[model samples]
Target: MCESPVRHAHSLLFVPATRPERFVKALASGADCIIVDLEDAVAEGSKDSAREQLAQHLPQLTPGQLTRTVVRINAVGTRWHEADLALLRNWTMHGATVMLPKCEDAATLRGVAQKLGDGARIVALIESLAGLDAADALAREPHVVRLAFGHLDFQLDVGIHATADEPELAFARSALVAASRRARLPAPVDGVTTDTGSAERLAVDARRARAFGFGGKLCIHPNQVAGVNEAFGHTEAERAWARRVLEEAARHGGEAFSLDGRMIDLPVIRAAEAILGG
Candidate 1:
C-alpha cells in the first residue's frame, strides 16, 4: 500500500521491513532510493517485530545513505500504523523519507505533519476511491512532496481485473499527475511493475509512466532498477533544460523564481538536480 519517495528518485526499490538482512543488499542495489517496507511486505503477526527490527537498523545508515533510503509504513486503518508513527516520532532518523499508504485526504497528512513536524518528507499514496477523489487535497498538503498511483490496489478497490497494460488506469494516473503539477509538487511516482523478471516489460512500463508525466517507478526487485532508471533517464534536451532551470534559479537567488513562465521552486529545483545528477 506504500506510495513513493519525496526526494528525486528514478527507481525506488522496496525491501521487506521484516527482512532486515536484506537492507544492506538493497542499499547496494543501485536504486535511487531503497524503501524498507512495513506494510504488505510484513505479515500481520509480524508487524511489531518488523517495526522493531527496522527501527534498530534504520538509524545505522549514514547521512548519505539516509538520503537515498526511505521507510514505507503501514496504512492508516491498520493496527500497525499507530505503532509505526510512534516509532518514527521517537526515532533519531536524520532525514528519513516516510511513505504514507492509503492517503485519502489532507487531514491525515496534517496529523502526520504535526507528529513528524517537518522532520520527515511524505509521499502520499492514492490507492482507494477516496484517495483518488482527494488527490488534489493530498497534493496540497505541505509535508507531501510527491504523490504515487497505487494502481494495483486501486484496481482492486474499483473491481477492475486489469493487467499491467495500464490502459484501464490511464485516467487515474493522469489525475494524479495533474494534481501534482497543480500543487507544484514533483511529478508523481508510478506504481511498481509486478513483472520484475521481464526487463522489457519493465522498461515499457517505465516509459509509459514517464510519458504520463511521472518522474519515477517503484521496483519490487533490484533487477528492475536499471531498466526503470534507463527508461526515466534524462535525454540531451532534458539535460540542457535542467541547466537552464538551475541557471535561472541561481540568477534569482534561488527563491520562488520563474523561467519560461514555469514557477521554479523546490520541486522544480529537485527535478533539475535529478536531471543534472546534482
Candidate 2:
C-alpha cells in the first residue's frame, strides 16, 4: 500500500482541478498536502474538462509530488463520480491519494476502495449528518487514511449558521476527533475557514481546530497555508516541555511523576511523546 501523505499534514490546500497551472504552485506553497478538487470547486458544466486536464497533468508530477497530491473526486452516486474513479485508475499509478467528498457509509467507501485497489488511500470528507453519524465506521475503513470535517456543508446540512469561531459545530468537531482517535487514525482535519480575506480569522480558526484535538486544517488559499501550519505545529515552548517530561520520566524509570506542579501520568507521557514526535 502507498504511504499516506495526510498522517502528519498540518495544512491541506485545495486547488481547483480545472486550473492545472496552479497545481505546481500550490505544491510549492509549503502546504503539507495539495488537494486538487473536482467536487464543489469545479462547476457541473466543467467537470469533464477538469478531469481531462487532471489526467493530462498528473503523470507529469514526480513520485514525491504525487505522494503529496490528493485528488478530490465528486461524491459517490454523482454522475461524475465513476468517471473520476475511471480516470484515477490510470493516472494514480504513482500513488497519489484521493479525497472522497460527502462520504457517509462503509459500503460506499469500501466499493470505492476496491475500485482504486491496492496502494490507493482515501481521505474521507464528512459533510452531512449522515456522514457525522457514520464517522466511526468511516474511520475504521482500512483504506481511509484520514477523516476531514466539511463544516461549511455540515452547517448547511444541520441547519446551523455558525460564526467564524463556529461554536455551533463544537459537537461535530469533537465527534470527528473522537472517532479518529478511537480508530487509531491521525487527528482529524478541521474544515476550511472560508473567510480567506482575514489572516486573523484563518489563524484563529486553525488554532481553535488544534485546541479541539485536530491535527490539521483545510486551506482554501495558498496564503492560509502558513497560518494553518503554524497553528497546528508545536511551539518551541511545547517542545521544551515535552523534552523535560521525557527526561524526568526516564529519570523516574517510566513511573508516574510530577512536572510543573502537575501529575505526569501515562496519558500525559504519551501526549508529550506525540508533541515531540511531531
Candidate 3:
C-alpha cells in the first residue's frame, strides 16, 4: 500500500466540475481540499462536457497551491469511467487524489490503482450496501488512502430512515471506522449535509460524526466549512486533558493512573494523544 502524509483537519469541498464558472470560486473557498466532482453532481447529458471541461482546466493547476485538488470520477460500471481515466492519465496537478465512488470490491479498486501507478492517491467512497459489506477488503487495497461515507445514496440503497441521529446508518459508519483503523489509514470521513446555510445544523451533524470516530467530513457548500473544521479540530480543553493524561501515565511508569478522580487506561491515553495529534 502506498503511504500518504498524515492528513490534517481537512474540509473537503465538493463542486461540480461541469460548471467551469464555479471551479475557481470553489478553489478560493478556504477548503483544505477541493473535489472536482464528476459524479452525482453532474447530469447524465453533461458528463461528456464535464469531462472536457475537467481536462482543459486540470492542466492549469500549479504545485504548492493552497488547496489540495482532487477529481471525483464516476463509478467503474458507468460510461464516464473510461473517458475520466483517460483524461486523468495525462492531467498534471499536485498529488491528484482520485475519489472512486460506489466502490464495491477490491478488484475494482485494484484496477483503478493500476491505472494511477503510484502517482495518484485513491479515496474510496463506500456508498452502497455492498461497498459497506466489503469495506475491510477494499481498505486493504494498497491505493486506498481514505474512506468517505456517501450517506445520501447509502440511505436510498439500504432503505434506511435518515435523521440527524441516523441510528439505522450507525452500523455502516462503524464498519468503515473499523476498516480504516485495521488498514492503518486516517479515520474515515463522514458524508455531506445538503442544507447549505444552516450552520447550526451543520455543527450538530459534524459533532455527531466526530463522536462516531470520523476524522473529517464532506461539504456541499462553502458556508459549512468553518463549522465542520471547528467540530473536527481539537479544542484547548481537549489538548490540556490529553497532556495531563500523558503526564500522569508517565509518572506511573506506564501503569494505569487516574486524573481528576477518573481512571485513565491505555485506550484513554491513546485517544487523548490522537486528539492532540501526537
Kindly list the per-residue Cα lDDT of model 2 for residues 32-63, writing each as its tens digit.
99999999999999999999999999978988
- lDDT digits (tens) for residues 45-160 of candidate 3: 99999989887876676653322776899889888898888777654224667889998989978988777665657889988999998899998887777899999899999888
Error of 2 at 7 (Å): 1.9
* Highest TM-score against the true fold, candidate: 2
Rank the candidate models, highest TM-score first. Answer: 2, 3, 1
What's the distance in Å from true for residue 47, model 1?
Answer: 0.6
Cα RMSD for candidates in order: 6.1, 1.4, 2.5
> What is the alpha-carbon RMSD of candidate 3 to the true structure?
2.5
| Stretches of model 2 off by over 4 angstroms after superposition | none
What TM-score against the true fold does each predicted structure earn? 0.83, 0.96, 0.89
- The lDDT values for all models are 0.83, 0.91, 0.81
Query: C-alpha displacement of 274 in model 1, angstroms?
Result: 9.2
Q: Which residue pairs in model 3 clash with each other?
A: none
lDDT of 1 by residue, 1-278 (tens): 12323456888889999888888888888888888899988899999999989889976877677767777898877778888988876432466778899998789778986786556678898898889999999999877878888888999999988765769888899999999999998888999988767888888899999999898988999899888888888779899999998888888886898678888898998989877983
Q: List the residue pairs that clash in candidate 2.
A: none
